[model samples]
Target: MMAKYGACLLCLSASVVGSAQAESLAISALGNLDLSYTQPQRVASYEGSPLPAQVEILPGNDYWISTPENIQQVHFLVGQGQRVSKGQAIVKLTGPEVFHYLAQVEAAASLYQLAKSRYERNKPLLANGSISAEKWREISQDYFTTHLEYEHMQHFMERVHSTDAATDSLVVAAPVDGIVKLNAISGPYMAGDQLFSMVPNNSIRVKVNVPTGQSHSLSAININQCHIAIESLSAIAEGAFVTAWSSAVPQECNLLLGQQMTVVPEYQKAVYLLPKNSVFSWEQDSQVFTLSDNQLNALTVDILGSTPEQYIVASDQDLSQLQVLSQSVAAVKGIMLGLGGE
Candidate 1:
């Protein structure tokens, strides 16, 4: 290293060096620096570190499955994450309450048929004045009450079907196409207890919890190197973090519901990516040394973000025409501070 800066070091050294330096200093003065230069890379966007993310179902898309009857025994026909279509059986049930309901429905059907027959047979008699009006009114009332009970039973039957009449077993079918999210084990469940839960394919989304200080205005996230556009972010904050939400992934993404994965946030903006060593602090401002006409000139820049090896920065002046010092920054700074003369 060159030791002799002499009086020039004290006279020229300044606290802050701007790009307007008129002195065309020779590079040889900063001895054995092994200096190197690099051009800043102009990019439209850059990716940050991978953040933890999870696939979740929106609250409005949750479908809860329950029955009014006490479930003494339950057998799940489908597993978690299993895709199913409407009318597909999801669980089998066998309980005293189930059988009792079936028996009651059968009895209601029989009584409805008997009432209907009597009503039809006596109608002509009433019309011809052969039967009293009071007696005809009684027949009409029986038919109406029995028919109402039978219709209610029929609707209950639609919710569950008899898988084995002798065994008193019934199967509950899915009401819509979706994937099973919460599946109950083969055990007893109280009346109205949740037996299963599901979500439609299009209702799934990616959720990411980002630190409050970082940028949250993101429109896309990368998973497994595939970029997926974000639909929105939660307006409120959860303590020190904010939640970012992504739209439903397409079939081509091959992402499964309830799957957890890392995601990289991406945004569109013009920025310059420069080497880490090329930048230095000058008067609390980030500055880089530019080489032109054999002279080193310091230029200030705004640091937007940074990685371990690169700093994502922005500058009002066009940096494309200037070459930045990529190496030997510390030695150059010491010389500029007049310390090399010691």
Candidate 2:
């Protein structure tokens, strides 16, 4: 069956080529091949098919809330997915570390007061030459050291919301306004253990990986058919791909953090779109036959992108103004290849 089909195609191609010089035979051959022409659609820009992308929390907008000390009992004040304000109490913690740090703050305060008083008392004595300069210097050093220690301890207590040290339990507050996410378990947690996560102001962005093969100017990109502003494109290519980031997405888009989806990328360039059947491969390059003055001429085209039934292409000649073979393309292409001694 295949050998007979090949012989028939060869005969048809030879007849078509042989009648090229005679208008009557050429017209009849063209009619028998069922050839028709179509003009390409021209556009300023074009978007390819959907490419994979991921929604990610913007850098610096993600906060990991952690415990400052070993916690025996952990209770979340805010529920998961709750919106919390800055400095709002988010967690209630109970542990021996809390009381231990509170006592340290009080002891540092007493030492600071004593050192400060001695420093003040020796100032006048040193001015009047009653106390040696070396003794006054020693007192001044003690005063500054004690003051720093007191401030350090005071700040630590304030961090855990136990500045007064009046309670055995400590309360930790949110560092910024954001949506809360729980990470802690029911059991006790060690120091620096992440208790929850916060996404500040819903600042999340979409990330796309553009292949290095794409060299045209990227004009726009859309997720779920919703246009998104491109925040940045990385200058350095990682392996075979370059990363691109979108601006903070709107809440209505309903994109979730770490969610992967399809994105359409459009390039800014004038190109022509033709039906997929109109194009054919010739000598390892894409080419289409254009009809002009009763003659069919092959023109090479640069394929930029494609759809299910159409191809986005570019050529040196303006394909928008010319008629290209749209039907019986394979038969005509085979004839052209036969004439070319292929």
Candidate 3:
């Protein structure tokens, strides 16, 4: 709001009062200082110290697919990095294991059928007291047990591959629409190894590393109160709290899996978030100038934490008289000294 750096006699006007409306001070080669009232912005501060963190590519549960077992003669139907629709066929596979599994399933099916037939034939006999209750119960148990076994095998076979393969080989499809990992389906792979990795491509989180000595502060942080600044990229983002963890690495980021990072974790405590330029230091006291009755007064503020451009301060005084200064306040002490000499 400053029009110009209007000159005033320090000795004559420093202690005086007037009806002149509060006006901003503008200094050339400097900045403008607003005389308008501005109260300190109060916020919750985390006393928990900050520690090094890492930005990790967390695999979302949306559809993290992996190979179930050793697959033989695996051939991917899609190219690497190709977007695949949910339930779309992604791979063709064959293995001796599938045939062995199918044989067991067929055997279980035959036993189930025989037991079911015997149970049905005895139902009338048991009702007419032709068969003992104990015998009927034994037959029912065998039928149910075999039926359950057969169903289990059938379910396993259903997932052995997709159902639409033209050959005897098993076909596997993507569980969600995602880019196929080009290298995942070229050759046979063992069970439990990564088949492919995909991200929602944009959904990501930063995991901050708190040393064993400092992790005690983690309990106080909630998802919304955490902030992560990617040091290398100069990007900052809020964090969503995580309870569970995974080991899957990100497919793409200008980051390594083990890169260290910094996270600004916050907790609820009375404090102020202020621009660094607004606060000034004198001797041992860090203060900000507040205006009242057209006079400037300084209030001591205890700084709690600071970022490159902000300061978190803990103070006990009321902020009703606080004024936001727009011009450089580095010379505030010099003005105060001039007043003392008056």
- Superposed on all Cα atoms, the candidates' RMSDs to the truth, in angstroms, are 10.9, 9.8, 12.2
* Candidate 2 per-residue lDDT over residues 105-171, each given as its tens digit: 7799999999999998888898899988888889999999999999966664554543324556778
Off by over 4 Å in 1: 1-39, 99-166, 182-187, 250-261, 283-285, 290-297, 302-310, 315-332, 339-342
Writing each residue's lDDT as its tens digit, candidate 1 over 33-84 gives 7888999888766555567998888668877777657878888888878878
Supply the TM-score for candidate 2. Answer: 0.66
Error of 3 at 98 (Å): 4.0
- Output the TM-score of candidate 3: 0.49
| Candidates ranked by lDDT | 1, 2, 3
Model-by-model lDDT, in order? 0.74, 0.71, 0.53
lDDT per residue, candidate 3, 104-159, as tens digits? 77799999999999999999999899999899989999999999999966754554
User: Which candidate should be chosen as best, given TM-score against the real structure?
Assistant: 2
Q: Order of all candidates by TM-score, from best down to worst? A: 2, 1, 3
| Model 3 stretches with alpha carbons more than 4 Å out | 1-71, 79-83, 95-107, 113-137, 160-167, 177-277, 282-285, 291-297, 302-321, 324-342
* CA lDDT, candidate 2, residue 196: 82
